[model samples]
Target: MNLPEFATTRTLNNCPAPAKLNLFLHVTGRRPDGYHLLQTVFQLVDFSDLLHFEVRADGQVRRTTEIPGVPQESDLIVRAARLLQNAIHDRTGAAAPGADIAIEKNLPMGGGLGGGSSDAATTLMALNHLWQGGLSREELMVLGLQLGADVPFFLFGRNAFAEGIGESLQKLDTPGLWFVIIQPGVTIPTALIFSSSELTRSTKPVKMTDFSIASKKLFGKNDLEPVAARQFPEVADAIKWLGKHGDARMTGSGACVFCGFTQEEQADEVLKLVPNRWKAWKAKAMQEHPLAGLLDR
Candidate 1:
């Protein structure tokens, strides 16, 4: 994969949009607007989806690839490109160039991995560079948030401790760990989990300092996990199976569960033992996104 040279590159190929694990999610409270206040660490992993981009002189953003069950208009990648195009035009009064975007998706939909959001973030970054939009990372982050709460974290380009419905981000250094993630063969709707009356929304918020101390032992927990596990037996069964090896927990909402290992060998050993019935893989924790350099600092 060639690194994108902002000034000269008309096409950015094999751009990576990595998946994330919510190290721990705590729903601290609910706003009057009905958005849940959340505290969680967004850990980027080596697992990712690849995207290809080619600049178009004609001002029309189009997704050339078809994703089953996802309409092109509704795809975050397309929406993100259009959003940036409109923003650029509105700011400069110049007809912004567009892009033909193709995605090589590896991440599962609704698996609690932030796949779609990450893809949207990658599109924003790639096109901003390709189009010379001159938007700062902070500016791009603002645009990303309009697509989804999780999008800004990817554009933020580092492993982050996130709050305020997962948008307010503070950088945090985490262990160089390996993770074995299991996909439970079902897609979990995040709204379903959040709307459940059984879900608890009153986990006391903890300070960054507390997490710094407790991270060594992987302290804190996902308050949404129990509700998801009870509603989706596949999630419950996966957590139960992986727990025998270590402390296994669901990542975001449901349908995927993970356990951390200090060593790659340990993660590999556990990965080999995962049940064939479940889809599982191992990945190393990433310090920053692969496309972090594309943004102007």
Candidate 2:
């Protein structure tokens, strides 16, 4: 793939696309447009996907590899590059920004881990720097919002208490925790869960300041759990099994369920107990997004 270029041979590598967990997701209401209103805490995890970019001279933005079940044109990585490219040309009348982007996809698709959104956010940040796009961090975030709701939060660069369909956010200095996340070897479609009649759309929202490490038990429930659990028995089983270990919650609209541990060894121990039928990962919580420093620049 070639991108409109002004003659540079720079390559950006090892840019990280981290995953996120909704420590708790609450659906408080539904908009006339059919979007669900949400309140939740988003925590970054050490687990991540990596993306590498190489400048192209032909002015074509493309993904170097084809993703299964995802068309190249529709890949968030490709779309994000195009969006930034368009923004650049619109801003400077420069040729379309172009690059051949290769993503190391580590996060599970449809696991509700914000993998795609994080990947998109990283693309925006990486390309902005690669092309000297001059768009500020906040500007790229606004641009990311057009790609997906979770995109802005990833760009926000910190753990956040989010609301209003999750575009609104307030940073949180959440206590670190280790997690044993189990995927039921199934994918939970977000749209299906959101539209399910079983989904609870009325949970009293809480103040961000009201959240405390001491009171974690109070905010541990995800309003979408019932729907996902009902639709996927594996989710129910995973949740039930993990609950014996600690406070188990479904992160976002997921088939992936997780339990938190105060120690890495504790999480590792539980990871060993995860049934062979499911996929388990031991991850440590992060205070900020892996690309948090990029936002400051």
Which candidate's lDDT is highest? 1
Residue 264, model 1, lDDT: 93
Give, for candidate 1, the lowest lDDT window spanning 10 residues.
Answer: 1-10
RMSD of 1: 1.5
User: Candidate 1 on 1-297: residue-level lDDT in tens?
Assistant: 334444447888888899999999999999999999999999999999999999999988899999999999999999999999989988899988988999888999999999999999999999998898999899999999999999999999999999999989999999898999999999999999999999899999899889999877676999999999998999999999999989899999877899999999999999999989999999899999999988854
Candidate 2 structure quality by residue, lDDT tens digits, 47-143: 8888888888788988987689989988888889999989999999998658989887889999989999999998998888778888887888889
Query: How close is every model to the real structure, measured as TM-score?
Result: 0.97, 0.94
Could you tell me which residue pairs clash in candidate 1? none
**What lDDT does the true structure give each of the candidates?**
0.92, 0.84
Give the clash count for model 2. Answer: 6
